[model samples]
Target chain A: MDRQLVFELPNDLGCIEGAVEFVLLRCEFCEEVSRRLRFNFRVSLAEALANAMLYGNGGDPAKRVRVEVTVESSALQARITDQGSGFDPDRVPDPTAPEQLHRPCGRGIFLMRQLMDEVHYNDQGNAVTLVLRFQDTEALLREASA
Target chain B: MAFQVSREGDVLVVDVDGQLIVGNRQELKTRVLEELEKGEQKFLVDFSSTGYIDSSGLGVLVSLSKKIREQGGELRLSSLNEDLRTLFELTKLDSLFRIHDSREEGLQGF
Candidate 1:
């Protein structure tokens, strides 16, 4: 099965939950798949949206955020685009570093990457795409990847 | 977002009851900082009722922990679900913050 959802939102943190819930309620998955998807997708989405609103839009209420969700049999993808000048994701310091642990500002992108199977930032840096495959196949593909 | 603040022994326990995301993450900080302003220390945040949290929420916790520590106080977290625990571990904040399996355990030192 293939499903797609698109949500255009104001550059507001309050709107994030509606976008997440609307798309999640529409996804039909088994119990295991659902559990993993709920945890991984929800966290990644929230982080992405916060980045879009805070950094990309600079917390400007006039700007907007566009989110697209695509659910295919093998994988799921969410793209969040904001209306602002993009930034260099590489410039973001590692929050996990010993010295940076006390800094509270830079962990959003790192969490998105860790939770999602693939995290890609657009060349402009204003948009990010998060991908998660349905089956990590830890019970099967461990040998292959390793 | 609602926070249940109470005193148990000398520790101030806050029961956070909502998804701590970008929107309401500040409420937690404001309330805790207020308590800090009032000279209340030894805080334990119980998350048994919290359903979701993002990086912003994590940032608030880190900042609060630092603030409390600077004030000669402590911020302890308890009752995080498996996903949240993994989140803390992945960010390496599990090393920075003292986390307990339950509220009782979190209150042990305080």
Candidate 2:
């Protein structure tokens, strides 16, 4: 089975938790995605949404963030678009670097890349797509049965 | 998210409940700084009841860790659930901060 969700949320941090919960609940109904996978996806989605709201839209309530989520038997994907002039993802500093470790910012993009199977950004950088593929679903089902 | 603070000798233990995401991360940072301003140095954040944390939450933790260290103090964490534990490990933050199996162990170190 395949499912999809689309949301246009304001640039408000208060809405992030509810959006994350909605994604996780949607994942629960998809059997092909395991519990562990759902948890990981939740984390990645949260980071992406935060980036769109805080960095992309600068938390402007007038601006909006658009999210599209698709869940299939073999994969899950989310595309987030923000209404601000985009910046280059390449300029983000590596949080793991010794010098950058203490900084409180710049970890969101890194985490989105780390947790998701694939992360892509548009040229303008205002939009990002996150993908997670599930290979060998039969094996996963068997393991769950065991 | 909500935070509860208690003191064990010189260490201030913060028990966090609910999701640690963007909106509430600043509160966590501000509270920690407030404690720092009070000259309370040794810090332990208990995540037993915390179900979720994003990069913003991790950033706050890193910031608090650095702020505490700059003040000649230390920050420790305890009781992270499996997901958060893996997050810390994936980010290699496990190497940056001291993580304990329990609050007692964290307190013992300070």
For the candidates in turn, chain A alone yields TM-scores of 0.89, 0.87
TM-score of 2: 0.92
- The DockQ-based CAPRI class assigned to model 2 is medium
Tens-place lDDT per residue, model 1, B22-101, is 88878999999999999998999999998887888899999999999999999999999998899999999999989999
Best by TM-score: 1
DockQ (model 2, Cα) = 0.80
Off by over 4 Å in 1: A30-32, A137-146
User: Pairs clashing in candidate 2?
Assistant: none
Best by DockQ: 1
Model 2 misplaced stretches (Cα beyond 4 Å): A136-146
**lDDT agreement with native, every candidate:** 0.87, 0.85
